[model samples]
Target: MLGLHKKWCLGICVVVYGQLLINALLTTNKTWNELDWLDILGEGGTALLILLWLYFILAARPGGRVTNLMGAGLLAFFVGVFQDALDEIFHMGASTPWHSVVESVASPLGMILMTVGLYFWRQEQGVVNRQLKKREKLFRQHQLVDTVTQITELNYFKYHLRIALSAKHVKRKFTLLLLDINQFNRVNQRFGNAEGDRILHAISELIMLNLRDDDLLSRYAGDRYAILLANTIEAEANVIGQELIAAIEHFAFKTLQGERVRLAASVGLACAREDSVDSILMRAKQALALAKQQTNSSALGQLVAV
Candidate 1:
């Protein structure tokens, strides 16, 4: 992730270098007896810790306005703290008032930027939380999260499926959509497993983006996604399934090596009936198999004609 934000990293490096140059040019080294070891230890250590935190933050998040703002704020704070540490070993003559300038200006500027960044971060989380409402249905289990897609696992989906079946509501039956990515294992064989995992994650996010606010999504089997459309009927869910298939058809996933990988999705659509979880799943699976067969035959026809 840090490698992805080269411009931000480069800008911080420049600021640090400029500060070092200014300090060296304007300030003279203090006498050995004049150096305050205690101040150096405290201020210097703090600056070091902040620098590490900046690195971790950059590594964790993608490049965006919020990330940029936070990185810039941390860098500004680093400059001020680092300059304070320098003050203990360097003589800040009357002509060189940078010590006062850095302490008074940089620290406050950093704080202000950080505060603004946090405000935007909160708004971002609100959107994410709304999306997750359909995912958990007021339930949470950290262990059920999938390693590849970071979505909930099959067991979690099954848990919710059983509940939806037993509960009596105006809309007694919910639509279940199972999507299997075509030739997923082939992707792992051609590219590395790491690249395949990235594709899985990408496809999962794409599906989530196309779903309604009240739909639950989870990882099922190796490369299949199970979606519970709580508020959607079979006809509406069928349209959504076709939309998902079309979306995947048009998606051009660029690999780390610059190769473009176009993906296809086969969706199985079924509506819930009674408390029969196994039957519902079996119907969906059968539908998915039929869809896959059609896709293969179509591809084969195209190749023969070409």
Candidate 2:
């Protein structure tokens, strides 16, 4: 991603500098006396603003529809203001009509494109906000989040689970679910590690979307996730596991080459007992193994009691 933004920055620099050079060469007879500080301030400021927009758009988002449209709009605005700023410093004479046309048309057209881009961006943000609402109550430390999956790591998850388990006189049953992506190594081998990470991230989002607001989801390790279902029994946990498995199976994740890959999840469920966290986790891991062995015939792994 850094490489992608670096290329964009280089392209912007080249275009802006190249436009200035061309303007300088064309204004062969111009004197420094023609320079207007006010015009330079206005047009140059606009150019700077357009560059800022481009930087924010590229830096904050992945390449997608909103980014593409916003990038194009900013590029158009940059080109427009770049020309206007040059025209103020140079006497283009007979070529001034073309310059006026470009300056007049490009900025407005760029604004219209930017408006459309902003509308789509708002829609995208709404979806993000809803997802955040679901996960925010479970945990709220932004710094401890995993970069690749954008969820909490295993340690934080364990910390919370231990707290929930120790609470006295809670009527609701607490269950732990551990899910491993079946044949996930094949995805990395076939589509490369980057695509495989994308798939894992997508799967993590899918799991969050399917879970209740009270549930805590985290990346346990490579190709595995740990979920804490507060106030859920084994029967209810099994149902949630099936839903997650179905969601992943139905998800048509595509590779960079536009090839769709189907996915399967093997889940293990274990209810909390009067034992240490390590013991409960071991039970879930053992159940997960059983679930993986049964993945061919069952949609979800077997539920094991402690």
State which candidate has the highest lDDT. Answer: 1
Candidate 2: tens digits of C-alpha lDDT, residues 46-153: 799879878878988887888778887888878888888877778876765777787888888888888899999999987886777545445478876787898888
lDDT of 1 by residue, 1-306 (tens): 889989877887898889878888887889999988888899999988988988998998998988988888888888888888888888886877768898778888988888888889899868877868756666778898898898888999898888888887956558888888888888888888899999999988898898877788899978899999886678878788888888888989989999998777788888776647888888888888877777786741110000
Error of 1 at 10 (Å): 28
Cα displacement (Å) at residue 48, model 2: 25
**lDDT of every model, 2 decimals:** 0.82, 0.82
Worst 10 residues of 1 by lDDT: 297-306
TM-score of 2: 0.56
lDDT of 2 at 170: 64
- For model 1, state the Cα shift of residue 199 in Å: 0.1
| Deviation of model 1 at 108, angstroms | 28
Q: Positional deviation of 291 in candidate 2, in angstroms?
A: 1.2
Report how far off residue 84 is in candidate 1 (Å).
Answer: 35
Error of 1 at 105 (Å): 33
